[model samples]
Target: MDGTIINSIASAERIWGDWARRQGLDVEKFMPTMHGARGIDTIRNLNLPGVDPAAESALIEKAEIADVDGVVPISGAIDFLASLPPERWAIVTSSPIALAKARLAAAGIPFPRFIVTAEDVKVGKPNPQCYILGAERLGVSPSECLVFEDVPAGIKAGEAAGADIMVITATHGHPVETPHSTISNYDGLHAHISDDGKLSVVRG
Candidate 1:
């Protein structure tokens, strides 16, 4: 849900940056690697000596769940989401359930009827498994879904799952280079369902 439905970057960076400093890693270098992936996988990828990825990840999740000070919905995210049929949409996020729900509540966005959180997946973003599962749970084929993402990992995951991608750049600090369609936020966009039940996103 982060970056797509809600902007949690401030809270995310604050907690992760603190963790990186405690780990004696360069915060700038480590910060970019943390987003769009599970905390445990991100920690494991560091391959730090004597660090338990699971433990570190759990701690990070706890901090994330508590730090909702700056978490808020992307502009127009609330109404845009409300405009869609609930069953036709699902949040597939790399965040664990508690953290995910916390952020969504903090952002004032409705909790999705169903969500694929970090706790539900063996592999995280860029694996395509999460998105694939999301589509399956929605009773739709991957090719029939339009996945919204911000980071490279999530974009890659959506593409790998064979779904059309719409990149959300509202919370992106750096320019995201993607050939797929892009939007700054959900503003002015509407979801339309035809009689055939095909969903199309239209811009005002």
Candidate 2:
């Protein structure tokens, strides 16, 4: 739901920056690593000195909730999603249910019938579990699905699940060295997902 469905990175950075300031850490140093990661996972992976676990968890939750303010739809995301038949697509995000719903609603995007959130998976992105589960819930084989992702970890997950993955460069700066195809936005993604489930990109 983050950089893909909604561009919440700026809000996330601001919230995390405030948390880092209160903890006497350099916000700039930590924010990069925090991007595209689950809130709790970001805290655990920090490996920072003198960081309190409970306080960190509370702060992260607060930041996540605070970020609800500036959520905006990514360019062409809504149109792309709406153009597809509901049965052919699903959302596999690292966000929990409430946040996902809030962001989607705020962006005025139609919620997918099948969604696999961070809370629903044993492992998050780069693990393939969430994408795999989303395909299962949608009753579609992984090979028949096309995934739109904005981060390397999510790209890895979808590709590992045998889906045709398309990386959006809005998040994570530029595309990483993943094998999946990359696009600047979702503008022409609909034509790419054809009737037989074969994927193609028509560049203009």
Candidate 3:
């Protein structure tokens, strides 16, 4: 999801930025840190004085679901995803279920049949738990899966889970640290599945 299948940056920044201002934190310093993290975890990490992490996290979830304006699919994401077999793919996102579905719907991306959201696992990204669970739910080994991620935490999770990783540069459009591959977006890439069930990616 987010920055991969859907471009929810506008809404995400708006909501999180507002939260930061309300909490008297530096929005510039705080914004990037929030990506690829669960809301609850993010709040706890902030460690703001006089704030309840759990309550704030719940509020953020509500805000994210309600602020779906400007959410849209990343370029070529819809077509590229449609070309793949559903059973071979799953979205392992740090977003909660409601926000994930709302973003997908707003972006016109079909909600994935196999999705692991923040609520689905005890620990979030960079822990490998969610990604591992995703592979398990997809009925595949970790080595058999390819994860597309935008942020460092998600990339680390995919790596820790023993899956190949493709870092999407849509968020910052900069080189990442040691990803298996990097793509600007889903544009100009082709996915092919052999009769023997081998998947191949070709750059067009």
State each model's CA lDDT, in order: 0.92, 0.74, 0.87
- Model 1 lowest lDDT segment of ten: 169-178
**Candidate 3 on 180-199: residue-level lDDT in tens?**
67888888776898899898
lDDT of 2 by residue, 1-204 (tens): 687767888677778888778877777787776666566666766676877654676666655765677778887888777766677678888776776787778778878888888689776778898888998998878987878787767777888999887777766664367666777767655546668775454544
Ranking by TM-score: 1, 3, 2
Clashes of 2: 0
Considering every candidate listed, which one attains the maximal TM-score?
Answer: 1
Off by over 4 Å in 1: none
Candidate 1 similarity to native, TM-score: 0.98
Candidate 3 similarity to native, TM-score: 0.95
Q: Which stretches of candidate 2 lie over 4 Å from their true place?
A: 48-55, 172-178, 191-204
- Per-candidate TM-score against the hidden true structure: 0.98, 0.83, 0.95
**Candidate 2: deviation at residue 74, Å?**
1.2
